[model samples]
Target: MPENTPLLSVRDLSKTYQAASGPVEAIGSITFDVRPGELVCIVGPSGCGKTTLLKCLAGLLAPTSGSVTLDGAEVREPPKKMALVFQEYGRSLYPWLTVRDNVALPLKARGVPKAERQALVERAVEEVGLGHAMTTYPWQLSGGMQQRVAIARAVAYQPEILVMDEPFAAVDAQTRADLEDLVRRVWKDLGVTVLFVTHDIDESVYLGERVLVLSSSPTFVQEDLTVDLPAERDQLTTRALPRFTELRTHVYEQIQRAKRGEAVAATP
Candidate 1:
């Protein structure tokens, strides 16, 4: 794929579910593109159908109209070249499996050879700074460490695009910061395309090269604002920047407007 072309494209996508009460619209229409090796964060008002949009992108659910295409292929089911990391680390990891086995599960399922799988697992685990706990079980690790294991699992899959659904939401503030840095490091090191969904305005601003803000349900993209922060960022120094404050404040104001039923047109 050309570097300038979108690695993932979503166009005119919408979802309406058949509910007991009546047809319920979640995403009214959404359009966005994630280019190769870009780290894009998605933020929205509460109940703005972020998860619903993610599900459609991952091909876990079909859209009512429009389309999600990964690379050049339409995504009708979970794509093998894509990997997902959910927020609930405790639920995603296996209590019975050691860290190595948990991280190796996806590779093994894809029919990766034992020797090659072990190498990928080891490298991914080390990348996430969990090399010392390769034998530790999920039940024995801290919540943050467990989330690291989940991230390692996704990394080992060697996905072309990684879609993370609020993966840091369950950790403490300090741990969340650490995990956020870890994501940046891995993204830089591996050059994987990342589409992260989070409800955190500050986090979205801090982590993304561009932040796509969604409006209240039935939702449409409220704004697709470029985050002009430096490419290299640290929690303390980056957050202290005056530009960072302006960006977050802008995103917050957009969310407020969205909640008030004000919406801009979907990006074409």
Candidate 2:
């Protein structure tokens, strides 16, 4: 693929589930792409098919009507080049395994040698500031710490793209803020393409280079807003800026309209 080509592309993607009431459309035809090193956030109301979209993008579920391609290849199943961090970190991590082992599992599955895997795991743990807890089990750590372990595991794999599905939703406000910044820092340092889904408007604007807003159930892209905030964004300064407030208001109004089944204008 060309350097400028998107790392991942979704072409007219749609998903439907067979229900007793007949076919229920979860996501309507929608299209988007994630460029290498770009951070894209998707936001929508509850039951707006955000999770369905993530599942399709991660190749965990096949789309009923469109395609997701990575590096010019169709994603038929879970792609080794992509890693997902879900909201439920407790369930995502193994309680029986030490933090180090949990972080190393993906590497081991990929046939990475023990020596390299150990080095990668250690580096990742330290990056997430969990170096001192390598021997700790998931059940022993606080919710924030366990989530950090999950992130470390994803980073250690060094996937071409990282897909986060409301990864911080289960955490407290303070921890969620901290994790948001951590994700931004990691994205900047590692330069991996990111696709983050969230219901939090502030979070979507805070962490994303561009925010993609989706309509209500049977969802489609409602608006795509490019966040023009400075690269060195902090919660206090960035959130208080006029531009930040403007963007947040814009997205908030768009989502409201989406819930009403009205077309929303793209961000100017």
Candidate 3:
């Protein structure tokens, strides 16, 4: 593929489930593109099909209509080039395995040699600032640390795209800030395309190169707002910038408008 091509593309994607009442549409036809090494944050009102869209992108759930393509290939199943980090790290990480082994599992599944797996695990752990916790179990660490282990696991897989679903939603304010910085740093250092789904307006503005807002249920793309923040983001300095505040306020108002039953036109 050409270097300028998008790393991922969602074309007219929509998901509808057959419920007892009637056809329950999770998202209306949605379309968007994530370019190579770009950080895109998706924000939407409650029950706006954010999770459904994510599942479609990750190939966890097939879309009722349309399709998702990664690296110019249709996503029929979970692609090895992508990795996902869910909100519930407590359930995601295996309690029985030490941090190093947990991060190494995906590598092992891919048939990586022992030495290569160990080296990757070491690098991933250090990237997340968990080098000292490599010997610790998931249950032995704090919630934030456990999430870092989960991130390390994803990193060790060496995926080209990282999909994070509310990864910082459960952490305390301070911890969330630290994790956000960690993700930004790692994404830049590794040049991985990232699609982050979060409900937090501030977070979306602080971390994304652009923010995509989804309308209420039967969701479609409401707006695609570019975040004009600096690439070198600091938790304190970035968040304090007037531009950050402006972007965040726009996203917040859009969500509120979406919840009020405003019809959102799909973006081309």
Full-model lDDT for every candidate: 0.94, 0.92, 0.90
Q: Over the stretch 157-264, how does candidate 1's per-residue lDDT look in tens digits?
A: 999999999999989999999999999998999999999999999999999999999999988887889998999999999999999999999999999999898676
lDDT of 1: 0.94
Model 2 global lDDT (CA atoms, 0 to 1):
0.92
RMSD per candidate (Å) reads: 1.0, 1.8, 1.1
Compute each candidate's TM-score over C-alphas.
Answer: 0.98, 0.97, 0.97
lDDT of 2 by residue, 108-127 (tens): 99999999999999999999
Clashes of 1: 0
Better model by TM-score: candidate 1 vs candidate 2: 1
Better lDDT candidate (1, 2) = 1
| Candidate no. 1 TM-score | 0.98
Off by over 4 Å in 3: none
Find the 10 residues in a row with the least total lDDT in model 3: 259-268
Residue pairs clashing in model 3 are none
Which runs in model 2 stand beyond 4 Å of their true positions? 1-3, 264-268
